[model samples]
Target: MGNYQIIATAAMGLEALVAKEVRSLGYECEVENGKVIYSGDESAIARSNLWLRTADRIKIKVGEFKAYTFDELFEKTKALPWEKFLPEDAEFPVIGKSVKSKLFSVSDCQAIVKKAVVERMKKYYKRNSWFEENGAFYRIEIALLKDVATITIDASGQGLHKRGYRIDQGEAPLKETLAAALVMLTNWKADSPFIDPFCGSGTIPIEAAMIGQNIAPGFNREFVSEGWNWISSKVWDDARMEAEDLAKYDQPIDITGTDIDHRMVKIAQENAIEAGFADILQFKQMQVRDISTSKEYGVIVGNPPYGERLGEKKAVEQMYKEMGQAFGKLETWSIYILTSNEEFEQFYGKPATKKRKLFNGFIRTDLYQYWGKKPPRQNEMMK
Candidate 1:
């Protein structure tokens, strides 16, 4: 239960958001490229795994040091307090990555690290023979940048993006983490109207619903560290109970997801139902040009087709033009779109008020934002 260094890994361009989320959980974090580092105890592990919306995984940073040779790697790795995290019979597998380091062979580095940890464990547990490796899973990773190696153990078994919803999805469905980032980047309030025109699997709308309801994204998912004996189960139990108490299930939200493909619309509905937002979100089958709304100061967010293929570029450009015309009528509504097209602003017929570079999986995309005027106050409306 002593303080341990914890890391929350994030995708590029999302480190700041992840750091903000970590801070919101009452932990001060230092943001770095692709990861955020912080210090906390055993309960911090459970709380972070259950609450961090933008992080890819939560890891316990065992050690970090400069090692250029295999001997240096082995000695430094063996000297670390592996016994603090791993126990006898624990299934500890070593994975590694090296970048511009003297130990360029990733496989060899992994082997050396694994051997070192096994030696250290043997000394700690006083075991003479080989380990049965038939206990709780501890996935250890060694990441070498330049000559410095950072060793960590994965607390989250699977990627945090798997929120336990969406048993089915269309081709190239947006990841739950990226979808949550898109919603967090917007100024949409829980009381305001929200829509996703390209809601392929209802990720954006469902993530929005969760954010509006203050629901923990990882509430329904299990973590690899949940079975570890050193960490008390009461920590996880308390975190889940706190999440349940904080959720605003009765909070009214006006959100909708629409897609041109009826099958996708059906899929979105099914996903929404799985996420427990069946009655709260409305899914419709409609094209971008057909979208119409009378509500003022609303928000429209979409991840439209990028038309990556050579043959489909023209058709996608036309679709963008039509979308511009259709969406232009709603002057009071803010809009956000994600696409990889370099000429999106030209095709959309208006330059974006702001744009940010982000990665959707491996594809680089831009989030084009168009801000809208705020709605008048109730007193002013009455006047």
Candidate 2:
């Protein structure tokens, strides 16, 4: 098929990582504030939706222009080649958003954009009857930012994070996308031991297992564009076959997840099973303070309680102190903790070797990294 502009929308603070992933797929990309823009053919859509781990959604950039007034918005949107993408019976729904723009009424923008697209489609299709919209789905979005309107069609219906493995979750569950990002941020290898002391719903450990096995994050999920007639099924079939061929199913991985709550531990185990990592990853019920390992040069990553509520601050601080003491025993194991607590180092009793700012949803958090000395070479360790 012809080349089209594709945009991968990312969570704030993850744009760079998403862009890097796009580049890794052999496509050049431009990193914006909350999205990455790139050019690709029909296959690129399949490949990106299948491979992108940190992105929220993949969309087709139909058109973009500056629109400060309703007239401009309607006219600019109508001028686009909607007929090229949307079929006659396609179910097109318009979603709109306005950020720091003169045309700030989201509902009004949505109505005008919807009317404009319908008008364009009617003129192109040469039909008098209104569209029944009873066929395949096509979700359109009109975003107005700083007097500029960018319109796109959603390729992935549900968010990419819904990998279909998470049947259950805890109260404060970490998103699958963010969990994958946390794993990618580390230097952990598949051969090395990986642990998540606070693996709520087993997101981190399961994600680590997938990464270790070179499994595509979207391997088990379905994308809306897969059924589009414009794109051939061979493109998706080839991409999926490539992903399957690239995965190392027999690769050995040492990954573990633990939680103090027995119920959460059970939930983690269930989620792991659903994710097809039941045999490779181990989940248990244990407190962080009781964590101990004999493995060298291992990695420990966790998303602990941030104690954001006033009543939970003292207890969370104490938990952080205990965690610091427990994890400090592994001199040859690196540790990474994500929390919104600013006084984490003070409670941990040691300064982190490095720290990176990240967002856990809307809450600002820091990934405090404690670098451990690398283990001796294989010969030395074996000696």
Q: lDDT for model 1, on a 0 to 1 scale?
A: 0.94
RMSD of 2: 2.1
Candidate RMSDs in Å, in order, are 1.9, 2.1
Candidate 1 lDDT tens digits, 1-383: 78999999999999999999999999998999999999999989999998888999999999999999999999999999999999897999999999999999999999999999999998999988889999999999999999999999999999999999988999999999999999999999999999999999899999999999999999998999998999889999999999999999999999999999999999888988889999999999999999999898889999999999879999999999999999999888899999999899999999999999999999999999999877778448877
> Weakest 10 consecutive residues, lDDT, candidate 1?
373-382
Computed on alpha carbons, the lDDT of every model, listed in order, comes to 0.94, 0.94
Off by over 4 Å in 2: 378-383
